[model samples]
Target: MFALISLSDLENDFINPYDLTQRLNRFVALEYATQVVLVAVLLLGGKWFLAGLQAAMLVYLLHSWHVKQHTVDATDVFRQLPVQKKRRLIMFGSFLLFFVIITYRFIESIIHGLLTEEGRAHAKKLFQDAAASVHGY
Candidate 1:
């Protein structure tokens, strides 16, 4: 994984048609990347920014459909793959899917936890100030 990311030729790395087909790997990678970005923005409290990013990603994917048929091409990728590579691609894709989902959930929990904690602290402080004022402190 480290070596994969460190590779200078990211396009070449992602285009592997053997163990991990470019279609499956590329699609998963792009989705995972977008999800991570979304969660990161959510953690940073950039709700509006994340929404805009989502809209942009949607538009980009939609616009690119005319140039390339990813779904049909994915079938070709599968058909051309050797048996062993097909098995590996299936296992790798399943694992990648699980990892992406788990990571997103974990990030979501962290963001929710942070926001709830902050809200509680803010309410507590507000209450303390109100009580102090009432008591002329």
Candidate 2:
């Protein structure tokens, strides 16, 4: 999602209010769905550290979104900000911490995958295929 936003930013596609709002809404929905799945998995796995991290992330997301929504509803302070800037502010403010946990989980999964024999075989096959393609094989 951050990558999507970054690409959109690069393309300067959030200039339109409707597009920005739509993207933000989609982001919000994705965030909620992701958190729900993470929380459920953590609960089922009984991993203390990850469960705690997910809990903290969920709380932060809820609180930040709530506050931002209220702030936007209550005042004109953000009126001068561009739609893209506002989107960035809301997104980063809400999910930056969550991203840290996400990165940690991603790295952990990659390491775990590399540790398995099947995973190593799959990776080797992928690299071999890439090499074959590069060599026009």
Q: For each candidate, give its TM-score against the true structure.
A: 0.29, 0.47
Report the lDDT tens digits of candidate 2 across residue range 35-67. Answer: 878888978988677778677767766776676
lDDT of predicted model 2: 0.63
Candidate 2, pairs of clashing residues: none
lDDT of 1 by residue, 93-128 (tens): 544765676689688976776588786787689889
Assess the local accuracy of residue 51 in candidate 2 as a C-alpha lDDT between 0 and 100. 76
> In candidate 1, how many Å is residue 30 off?
30
TM-score of 1: 0.29
Scanning candidate 1 in windows of ten residues, the lowest lDDT window is: 2-11
Local lDDT at 39 for model 2: 82
CA lDDT, every model vs. true structure: 0.51, 0.63
Candidate 2, residue 129: Cα displacement in angstroms equals 17
Off by over 4 Å in 2: 1-14, 68-137
